[model samples]
Target: MTGSRSSSRRALLGAGAVLIPVAAVAVPVVQRAAERSAFLALCAAWHEAKDTHEQFYADNVRTFEDEQRVAGEIDRLDNVALRLEREIAGAPARTCAEMHAKAKVAERMGERASEDIAHSLVADILREGPGA
Candidate 1:
């Protein structure tokens, strides 16, 4: 019985070792994909709502419509579901730089968007701090 138990324990340990590498690789890949998806969605939303956002946040303040759009934006950010403390411990500097650049472009074009949009995006990305 002792021999069988010890053998079983060894087998489980061996399996865990193999699975660890697989899981490590897989987790980052999954996280990177999810992060990309979230980023793309925000870009798309900005593209579609740029004008409306400018009018809403910077000037006219369209109350009802802007509320809906803002809610959607917040919800999209939530969907990224980034594990910030874990993710930031990994390296994401490159991706953060890229995101910052994109935000700059969007800000400069805030005739199409308001400055607030760029600010919001940068703030959210930094807060998430997930790896590229």
Candidate 2:
């Protein structure tokens, strides 16, 4: 019984030793995948917000004040998009491929939230009365 217990313990330790390296390798890959997904989602959301802002400008922005406000929002979105682009460029090739594969899905999911953000901004602008 003592020999059997010792052999079982040794087998368990051996298995753990093999698993430790695998887990170590897997953790970074999983973390990178999560980070890539988050980055892509942010980019998709930014695109939606920028598109909504442009549409609002085209359809509803009549006054100079409203135009200026919308333009500023568009510029802000552009700057963030540029930053995201830079990050994407720096990402690993595999990460980029995975992100590209998933981007459209993320964009579709983000559209509603982006519209909400745009609506909130428009409401604030309207409440502030154009020039205020």
Q: What is the C-alpha RMSD of each candidate to the true structure, in Å?
A: 10.6, 15.7
Per-residue alpha-carbon lDDT of candidate 2 for residues 1-132, written as tens digits (9 for 90 to 100): 999999999999999999999999999999987876776666566566667656766885788887786787667766765555444334332343444433443354464334433343344345445455
Candidate 2 positional error at 2, Å: 1.9
Q: After superposing candidate 1 on the true structure, give the runs of residues whose Cα lies further than 4 Å from its correct spot.
A: 51-132
Which residue pairs in candidate 1 collide?
none
lDDT of 2 at 119: 44
- Would you estimate the TM-scores of all the predictions? 0.39, 0.52
> What would the TM-score be for candidate 2 when compared with the true structure?
0.52
Best by lDDT: 2
Candidate with the greatest TM-score versus the true structure: 2
CA lDDT of each prediction against the hidden true structure: 0.55, 0.59
